[model samples]
Target: MPGVVWIALAIVVTIALVLGLGASRLRTLSRRVGSFSCNARASGQDAWTAGIAQYAVGRIEWWRCWSLSPRPARTWYREQLELVGREPFDDDGPGHYLVRCRYEGLDFELDLAAGDYFGLASWLEAAPPGRRDLVL
Candidate 1:
């Protein structure tokens, strides 16, 4: 009977330790690394645009973001563009956009296509409002 109790305690301790490690790693990754700032002046644009940007700030995190750079930022943006029409740019259609979006608060612009942009928006939502407004 004593052996059984010890075994159970050992199992519990092991689980707790694993959970604690996971939580610790989560905390570490959640830390802000000070990237994703943004500024944009497109080819034909005269006005300078800027915003506070935040995204996962590590090498792996960035590559994950890069994977989602284009597509549709949000369902609304995708739908709205569809309603307006892709126009002479129609060939690219909703997925046609190959944009160099300035990551709000990050110095460099991420060049992305519309489909790729969809996943990026979810990441951007981690930021505060108007903090990720890099478009245009």
Candidate 2:
């Protein structure tokens, strides 16, 4: 029916607008660090969810890649974060390595590509002098 068609069109338009706005917001607010993908599990949560991390002025903002939300799901401040450990990814996926980090006494895992790994390492190392202390 004509009403059904109109409703479908409206739904499609709404979805498109949400996606466009989300992408625009992400690009305007943050810069791409590299081809980075991560699955993070909060300290108390047992499940891990996939997301992407963007470098902000003094912190890293992580957003769920599948969601259209404009706000970051988690923000890890540079000064309060420490690298715990790292290991090569076991699966043959795009991610090359897995990094474990502690922020504000909570642990988080980030999976990065080779380039993203270097970029993250550089970002941490380039923090203002005495801002971060390397654990290893």
Candidate 3:
């Protein structure tokens, strides 16, 4: 009975160590994500850059997601009604957002940043060509 107790203690210690390490990592991830922002206007490229960089080198395990999995990310973005008539997140636009860009296998965005939300759509989606208002 004493031998079983010793083995159980060792297993518990190992699990504790692993969880402690991961918890610390989560903290670092949170910090990085908080301070991350970028100006890649086209497709919100800058934000994606920052998001990936932060998601990488963090205490989280979402780094190098492309290396971890060889599939495209599951894209998610908030939809806004264009009263005049248009969809946001214009799939055909020039910007992209960091919806599931970080933290794989789960949804990452919780609170929506007005800038991140509106800006992403503006930067990424292509406007209708005639809307440019240029005189040839």
Candidate 4:
């Protein structure tokens, strides 16, 4: 093989390896308890970015699917998150719901599967009695 051909092969192999590793890591993370696939969009924006949401005590952490960083890209505290609205999401496909929420006064939306949406609702509703907002 020519020198150029060798270099091209090496580059392609490296790219494939990186993508494979990233995907494998994502699959592993998604299999963990309380983790679900979701897409998020900042309020007023039309783009939805793929990610995984993990429910942690007192908070929800989201990690972008394509990122290699061990830290979550975004975090919403149970105390700060307020559910604004929810509706069907047609942009992505069926069985997806768009949840509009406000955290610390900033609005954002999470696109989730029906099951995941129910899970999120349950998690929020299961907050400690002391943490629940009492309208009285």
Candidate 5:
């Protein structure tokens, strides 16, 4: 029927518009620190999955590349993060290096290009000096 066709077209257009708006809002809210491509393995999982990480304030927001949601899949706070080790790229892969880190009792591996590697390392290491409290 004509009415059914019109309703289907309207639904498709609405879905496209909503996805476009969500992507635009995500881009506007997050600042791109550097190029990132990575795989994450949860504590119990034996396999790795694709993810992307972006730095925001004092946290690293990790998002699943296949997801359309604007929210971060995982957020690693700076205060509870620790760098464990790094592995250099073995071949001509897209990732230049892989940095492993532990945050909030979970471990995550982040892959970065040469340029991004330095930025990520510096961001993690640039903690301010400790402040002492004065006795009243």
Candidate 6:
């Protein structure tokens, strides 16, 4: 009985440590420049995931909030994204919109606030000259 109790306590402690590390990593990522709260879903996915997005010179990096790794889970290059659709998303709020886009032949959706949506649009349009034309 005592042995079982000790094992359970150890498991609980390990889980807590992992959670703490993940949260710490998320905080560190959120403090970077151009970071914004964003929700993303892949095409055919039924659920959206919350994460932080940071804009780099020519790409956007998305990092899941509950992950322990520092690397971005997905990277969307500015030149490769094609806007498919944009509509007001009232599920979260009035100013939020669901932006659908295609990258590398795969479609995905991003739920973004008005300000963030505009920022993303501007980023897409500012791609370097001579790249494939992006139909917005």
Q: Which candidate achieves the best TM-score against the true structure?
A: 6
| Candidate 2 weakest ten by summed lDDT | 28-37
lDDT (10s digit) by residue, model 1, range 37-136: 2333343454534322334332113312212232212121221111111112233344433344322222223333354445455454444465454233
- As a whole number from 0 to 100, the lDDT of residue 7 in candidate 2 is 100
Which has the greatest lDDT? 6
Relative to the unseen true structure, what is the Cα RMSD of model 6?
Answer: 1.8
Regions of candidate 3 where Cα sits further than 4 Å from its true position: 33-136
Instruction: Flag regions of model 5 displaced more than 4 Å.
Output: 22-39, 43-52, 90-95, 130-136
- Candidate 5 vs candidate 6: the lDDT winner is 6
lDDT of 5 by residue, 18-135 (tens): 8887677556544465426656765445566666777788777887765677787888777777777777864437657766777777776665676677776787677555411110
Q: Would you list the clashing residue pairs of candidate 4? A: none
Scanning candidate 1 in windows of ten residues, the lowest lDDT window is 78-87
- Candidate 6, residue 4: CA error in Å? 2.7
Candidate 4 positional error at 133, Å = 3.6
Candidate 1 deviant stretches above 4 angstroms: 34-136
54-133, model 3: which lDDT tens digit per residue? 22221212232222232212322212112121223433244433232222333233122445545433532433554332
RMSD of candidates 1 onward, in order? 15.2, 3.5, 12.9, 2.6, 6.3, 1.8
**Shift of residue 115 alpha carbon in model 6, Å:** 0.7
* 1 against 2, candidate with superior lDDT: 2
Q: Between candidates 1 and 4, name the one with more favorable TM-score.
A: 4
